[model samples]
Target: MGLRFLVVEGNTRGARQAHKQAYGLTLSESYAEVLQEIEGGAVCDIAFPADEGANLPDAAGLESYDGIVLTGSHLNIYDRTPDIVRQIDLMRAVYASRTPSFGSCWGLQVAAVAADGDVRQNPLGREVGFARKLTPTEAGRAHPLLEGRPAAYDAPAIHLDMVTALPGDCTVLAGNAVSPVQAAEIRQDGGVFWGVQYHPEFSLGELAAILERRTDILVREGFCRTPEDALAYTADLAALHRDPTRFDLAWRHGIDAEVLEPQRRTREIRNFVEHRVKTEKSARGRA
Candidate 1:
């Protein structure tokens, strides 16, 4: 049998609907598409843990899947709302199940908070559009997840909250000046989670759509001097998405092959499947 994967969307129904309207795909849908693309013939199931009364897999049910992926969310984990609580509970169950898991952006926050770490609104402000110059630590340098990454690279990102305190069993992987916890590996209750602060599944077009929707915040937060400037910037991103060969636009944005190349951007996810998921499947006699 092919690999079976679960995609846990961290967004509520309303947020996901709005995201679908703006980006043409729900976050989990996009994540699932990427997973299928990476691992051919893989089966992916999506669950919305943040939705009220949403059905979630228990530990035994979770063990049926080879791996799990958590998607980014617009909600803050610190609020501890009922919806947020549900996601945390689900993640804890995942840890207990000892499943291999991976996450991005808000997903990373969920993993951190669920593991007894802390996440807070970044005092330095939001790191939107792209996280720049993420350098791997000593551990990350030798980590299989970052095996193909360069000494420093950029990736698409948009987040207001960051992990401030790490759990005892987590190792900091890569970090930039804006966020100290860029990428990490968390081992809790025999379960392992690899996560990054940036969105590997996001394309320039998706990010452009998001930026267009958040133009007001972009201007208010000084990411752009005016709404027109924000729209113009997003236009460049959209244009680049249409034609990645536009080196002029790439150079203007200082975006190199890391963000421009799909394989490089999603190296961690592929690594997780190859190193963690496949290895576990083989160990369980499922491979």
Candidate 2:
């Protein structure tokens, strides 16, 4: 049987609509596209736990999938609002179901909170665009999730909240100077989750859209001297996305093959499907 996967969108209805408007695709849609690209013949279903009245899969339903992916969001998990609470509940159910799971950005924060960890606004300020110099820990170097990752690398990212306290059953993987818990593996209640604070699923165009949306914030945060500068930077990112062969644009932004090459940029997501999802599916006779 072909692998079946579930994509849990962490964004609310409004945020998702905004994303669609700005990026031309909802976060979940982008995740589904990337998953299909990574594992052709794999099928994906999307769930919106953050939207009120949205139907979510129960434990049995969750267990039926070969793997689950949680997408990033604009909501703050620390707020404990109804929408946020619903996502937390769904994550707990995901854990109980023991399905192999992966998350990015807000997805990672949600998983952390559901597993008894904590998240807070980063004191060092928002780490936008690319997360730089992500060095793997000893555990990460040996971890399968980062099997093909270099000693130090960069990935597409944009977030202000970070995991402040880790769960008891989690192991820190890779971290950078900005955030100490960039990547981790959490094992709880027979379930395994591999997550990263960066967006391995994001395309350069998507990053440009996000930067465009947050132009004012980028300026206020001192990332750019003015909105025009921010827009100019995003234009360059979009241009590079249109044509990756633009070495001048790549050099201007100090970006390398790690962020420019699709395979290298999404290595973590591919690793999860191979090392966790496919491995477990085979062991369970579902392969």
For residues 48-127, what per-residue lDDT tens digits would candidate 1 score against the true structure? 98888888887789999999999999999989999999999999999989989999998899999889999999999999
Candidate 2, residues 87-136, lDDT tens digits: the string is 99999899999999999999899999999999999999999999999999
Q: Which clashing pairs does model 2 show?
A: none
Q: Which regions of candidate 1 fall more than 4 Å away from where they truly are?
A: none
Give the local distance difference test score of model 1: 0.93
TM-score of each: 0.98, 0.98
Error of 1 at 267 (Å): 0.8
